[model samples]
Target chain A: MKSRFKTGIVAAVAAAGLLLSGCGPAATGAGGETLTFMFRGGADEKAAYTKAIGEFEKANDVKVNMIVTTPDDYSTKLKAAIAGKKVPDVFYVDPGSVQAYVKTGVVKNISEFVEGSDSIDLDNIWQYGVDSYRFDGKLMGQGDIYALPKDVGPFSFGYNKTMFDEAGIPLPSADTPYTFDEFVDVAKKLTKDTNADGKLDQWGTGLNVQWNLQPFVWSNGADWLNQDRSKVTVDTPEFAESLQWFADLQNVAKVTPSVGEAQTLDTYQRWMQGQIGFFPVGPWDVSTYEKLPFEWDLIPYPAGSTGKSATWTGTLGIAVSNSSKAPEKAVELAKFLSANETAQQSLVDAGVQIPNLIDMSDQWVKDSTTKPANKQEFLDIVKDYGRGLPANSTYSAEWYDELFKNIQPVLDGKKTAAQYLKEAQPKMQKYLDQANQAAGIG
Target chain B: MSTITRRSTLHRKEQRVALIFVALPVIGFAVFTIFPLLFSVYASFTEWNGISAPVFTGLANFQAMMVDPYFWQAMWNTLFLMIGIPIGLSLSLLLALALNRKMRGTTFFRTVYYVPVISSIAAVAILWQWAFNGDFGLINQALAMIGIDGPNWLANTATVKPAIIIMSVWKGMGYSMLLYLAALQSVPRHLYEAASLDGAGVLQQFRNVTLPMLRPVTFFLVVTSIIGGSQIFIEINIMTPGGGPEFASASIVWYIWQKAFNYLQMGYATSMSLVLGLIVFAVTAIQFRLNRRNQFSID
Candidate 1:
């Protein structure tokens, strides 16, 4: 009886092993045909993408595995996935990451796909958006297009109209720009202590040095790199002066919150709570800020020494991965996400993104359902003065981050701007030179 | 002779069954742990980004480490974080001693203390970030009530490390307390009774009886906490990203992660990892040696 029981157990185990062997290939074969799409965004952005992706899946009769990650964890997770040889079929690509990703041969050049597709209207899309992903073998912005822009994020100022009214200050016109000095004066007036407390409860303006500070640096007629991108230009006196002026808004002018005060409630939170007069607003925040108790409107950044309001524009693009099994289908999905007017309109209506398609931006601006009275200002900046960041080369993010990291001491009034820039220039130049060499650029 | 043959056959069958049972896990260890360790050691000697082929560059990464000020700063920050371990261990021990007595609601107190250990690190970090805020934080508000101004706990370079240490101690004390509680339960009751009969006070009895009896548990806690404290990453990452006001709170593991992922300097990151691993191994070895020399009864 014991021998019979042992035989029964062995037979049962063999049958189970045979069943598992049969299941493995069948499972993979069925799922291998489905495409995977990965992106990074907050809740509203996710909801918009979910609606669009659902439409695409239903129309194409193809399954898509959507993966959403936070902006902080996206790069780490993507790199790990690539290293593990489980690269997603399509993924979000940023302008800063384009060169590095392309150099590593992870991103596919979809120019052939773009050229052949009759459905995609390249002429309708903004040229700057197209140029952002173009790589000419060695240099970016000139060659084959690796991705298509999902949205154009033009950085502009969003001012609380309710605060302006309460402060008895008239709203600034979108076309008429304020000089840096005049802007600071307006900010000083807007700052107040409403309840007559010893502490000031409201701030004039807030500046995120990492993001919004670029406009001031550019409008001051100072550049991070020279025209050719060969040498660091941040050591110039103009750059130092511009940076000092912006830093002084908090440290010297005493209008904005101190670094310590800002830590308690970030400028964004303060702005949402109707405590900040002005803050840099991107199109992505339109959906989030719609429910604010105060009225807000967009305006151009204040002009500086250059006599022009030069703003920084960022782009998020969709690209097919090189390791994708379904490259053709992935490119189709990328085009659907980025180029198709129907899909783009959904995102624009949701107030999460500005139109990437030219002429179609009027539709985005005319969407009366959205808040922000001066939506036209976003398009004006993008069309006239929007510029990408200076750190566009491969392996340059570290160097760019280093500049900001080391400059915190200067912003805190511990070091002079001139002194910090002089010390940081050589290190930044070294990184730029190495990155140029790595990317085979001069 | 026939009985001996039967016994040998049964022993061989038992051995075969044991091998079959252990094979799966041994294979998993080799694939997941051993293979990566060996590969990382090899990669440490080469120059490779995650995407490209690694180039042979002997000692270059190690040479770079010698002059890297950031690496040294990270090490210093890691050491600074370890200062909390001793303070944490002592506090936990006191709590364990108080709770170990047969008192009402001891289990309730134990559960309350253990809650933070089981809570998610991200959640705990967000809670602590709010508490450490300079202007409106609970800590600063409390300080203000007593006519003392609180420094910007997280934003100031001078106070950031201390703030991190305080949070670390609060979050980790529960684990140590439980361990000490277990050790206290096993302590022979007669040892304390004898000390009492000798006219010793409660404090003297604790020092003479409880502490010496709990030495092994203390030693274990010390060694493990040091190893754990020196590798703090999540707290710094969440509270003070980009090293928090001039890289004041960046630990060695945080630096390693930045190099590997942010900079794509995989080879350099691996080299740093190997060095960190060696440092941990050396410290643990010294602790074991000291423990052996003292000859504390672990069992």
Candidate 2:
């Protein structure tokens, strides 16, 4: 009797397993193929994607599930999904994460798909955007492609044209990058009390030290790391000099908002309200910046003694998950987001970013009637002086963060930049060493 | 003889049924708590990035943690924030005593105080972030009216932890007040009457009668508050996303979460978390032992 009961249980289990296995092929059959695409963006970005994704769905004859999150939550959410082994079929992968993803085999090597696709014109896309996602096992920006660029963010500099005109200050030349000395002089005049009240309502510049200081540092021939990206080199005199100059913008020149005033409104909001004279503008800010009360135009960021302009370009790559069952469809979805002309046109029209296609952006630059009248500056940065973010080449951003962790004292002018960086290098190097260990590099 | 055999078989069947009913939580405990805890112990000694196989690295993570200034700073910040627990407890006790009297609109006051206790923590954190802003914030504006200048509450290192502690106390005081209120009312009136008859004043009576009666609740609150305080992440994450000016406001849990998720140093994070868990465990154990030793006084 016991033997019969066991046999009955075994038969039932067999039937259940068969029933579950039976549904797998049916779902993958013809029109039933579904792929998940995850990316982070704001409202306009979401609208642009929603409008563009349908064409891809119709063309591929498959369903696509879209997961959109705010930029702040994207990395954390993506990491959570990866850890749970439920990675989206295709998702936004940044240059910074390329090494970690490839090392762990989380991302598919989609070089062949990207290179061989007749629809994608690699020659027409920005080389820097494509190279940023490449990893040769030892270094980033060169090797097998793991993802395709969604949008290349050129961190262009924008000045309030209204503020410049109202103050009767000479407009900055679009082609010539202002020397740091000349830039500081203009900023001093731009910083003022427009209402003649004791409290200053207007400011020249309000740049976060973490984000905006990089441009000055790089233009000064100083960097967070050495050329080979192996060691921390922020203790150099050039870095300290640039760092001190940036601090002096607020503490000495009083051109930017005081720390207390900034805590209330922050620099970004100040720019939106036409209070700030100069600010960094990314391609992603176009849609939001359109409705600002003041006129603004792009120009090269101020140059240091090096006589060169420098700032980072940010990009997100759409990567296929290695674990995806529908790899071909997933790869196609990535390709569509990156290079499909119709999709790129729609997204550009939505005013979220410049077109990923270089040929398309050239035409975009020709349109001089926009809020940023000097749209050509955006292309120039993408094609030239804009460097990949320092963190992009590292295995993790902990070392980059270490540079900014105790920066407040310097910013407040309580400590000199030289002393601060001198003390900070070892701490940064420790984290860099940890990062190398993680990347399986010395 | 046959009847006896059948009765014994019925008892065995009932025992089996009872065992089946108890197995669910046992299985849950094993899966959820015991398994992760055991895995964490193993992972703490290894180099795991939450992906790929964990390689045993023996005490490297712990050794690094000892010299890591950020780790120590985070620990100090977490411990510093618990200073509010005692301050909050005293404030709640005073409030409970006030509300215990036959006051007008006691129920309304009770409900109002408990509102924050039930309000969403994230929303509260965001609301407080705006209020603590420096130039034009509610706090500085009020301070300015009194001929005083307020520093940037969330931006300055010295003020950031206090600002967070103050917000935490405001959010948590209501819950503790409610518990103390319940404990206050449950104290026997006869004890207070006896104390009063023995020439004890209100303060004397409170110390002799009310304090003793509230000991158990206080013990419970202190243990739980320390545990909760140790794990504070939401307020810190929202109010000061960059870990609050050199990480002066980072708690152990927040640091652990950053290491595990943001930095992808899961093994190091796990080791820090294990240290945190053991600390909490030791603290709770000590509290329980003390409570047991002092049980006679309450009795």
Candidate 3:
């Protein structure tokens, strides 16, 4: 009887195994030809994507699935997805992580897709944006062009008009922002104790010691990486001088908020709440400031002794995953979303982003009805002074990590700017050299 | 005789049924906990980034430990937190003793104290981060009122770890207090009576009688606190980003996370984690041995 029972169980197991084996492959996706799109904008941004996808789906007769997250969460999640071998068909790739992702063999090389498609437009994008999307002299992005740079607020100093007026300090002119020395003077003037309780009740400037501090370093003719993007250039005298100037904002001038105070007041939120005098920020804050009680103006970051106007641009693009079952369909979706004029215009109108197609983006200038009052100032500064950090693909992840990591001590008055840069130079150079060697950039 | 034998057979069948029911849980443990632990041990010796093909590099990860400053910093932070266990445990014991007697609103106090433990760590971290904020924070504002210059508690290298330790004690003590309460309730009242008869006052009775009786409970608390405190992660992670102000507050577990997830150095992270696990085991073992040796031995 036991032998019979064992035989019955064996038969049942065999039948179940056969059934599982016959169930067929994983979901081939969206009616057997699926394309996945990853983006970092919130739900309101979905309307723009939905309209774009609507047109693409109709044109290609394929289905598109959208994955969305905030910019901050996007990189970590994307890395996990790629590492897990569960990559979506298409995703937004930040310039910082693009090289790392491409090197991992997880993203599809879309150079061939661009060659094959004549309907996509490439001429409308800025040269730097286009170059940023390339790896190994071959385009790794799709649609014969770069991902549309939705709304951009170029690097500029945002200041409270009320504070400046109250202090009797004239606003920095659009033609030329205050020089490093004058900027320090202005910060001190803005720093005042309103309550007169023998305590610092108001701060002159909000000290963002990371990306915001970069333009100052660049203005002093210091670059994070050398011309060949092979070594760190920050240990130079120019960068050291810039760091000293930055340290003075706190230690000598007492104009900038302490790091702990910055966290509590949240420099950005405080600027929006009209508590700060001047803040260096990007276009991300425009929407927040639109509702503020005080008038605000955007001015270019001040030039240093070198007289160079250095403004670093942040570019986010879209790429296809190598594991995607439908590469061609993914490219089609990328092209339709980025190159199509109707889609770009609709997105721009929705305040989704500053569209990247230069010729087609005339609307950003022409749409007088939608443009903010300060739009002209922002546009003028970005047009004249804008430049992007060389997208040294593999090193940006580590380089920026070091940049942001080391700023804490500098801001806290523990390390001088010169000391921080001197210590960080070797670390930055080591990684940049590694990346350059890996990419054969030299 | 036949009926008696039948009854014995029935009893044997019941025992078999009980054994079969118990066997399922043992199989589950072997499959889940035991198997994964063994697999992790093997993986720790390999260079596997979550997605890539794993290569065996026997002890390179372990060798890397000698110069990893982050590892030492984490160890120091763990030791820093160990300071809290005794502080928390003693306070909890005191509270438990005071509340053990029938008193008005004792239940209310216990409930209010446990509220923090039930609250989310993230919520607590947010509140503490603000309170410790260098400027415009409640703590700083209060200090200003007293003409004291408050340091940036979360941002300053010297004060960050202490701030976290104090917050942890506040959040952690109630549970330990409840455990002490349970242990206190189980102690016999006759021992205290006998001590009092021998001319012992309240303090003397507590030291001689109540303490000896609470030895097992104290030993249990110390062992568990050592294990838990050594693996502390959430408070430091949420309150301070990668141990802020140049990693002055980095804990060991946070480094493991940064290496594994952010740096994509999983093999290195796992090896370091193994070393940490061994360290925790040795420390816990030593603690248990010490507690056993020091356990009150009353005649």
Per-residue lDDT of model 3, residues B1-299, tens digit only: 99999999867865655555455567557766898688778778887655565678888777767776667877787788678888888888988988888989999999988899899998899899888878667888999999998988887778988888889889988898898899889878888888888999988988887887888888888888888887888888888975676777788888888777665567778888888889889988897788768866556
> What are the Cα lDDT values of the candidates?
0.84, 0.88, 0.71
For model 1, the superposed segments whose C-alpha errors exceed 4 Å read A1-32, A440-442, B1-14, B296-299
Candidate 2 or 1, higher DockQ? 1
Give model 1's docking category: acceptable
The TM-score between candidate 1 and the true structure equals 0.93
Give the per-residue lDDT of model 3 (tens digit) for A228-285: 4556677888888887777778777888665556663566666776667877656555
Q: What is the RMSD, in Å, between candidate 2 and the native fold over all Cα?
A: 3.7
Write candidate 1's Cα lDDT for B187-273 as tens digits.
988887888999999899988788888889989999998888778999999999878778889999999999888777889999999
**Model 2 agreement with the true structure over A237-272: per-residue lDDT tens digits:** 999999999999989988999977665257788889
Interface RMSD of each: 4.9, 6.8, 6.9
Which 10 successive residues of model 2 chain A have the least lDDT summed?
A18-27
Candidate with top DockQ is: 1
* Whole-model lDDT, model 3: 0.71
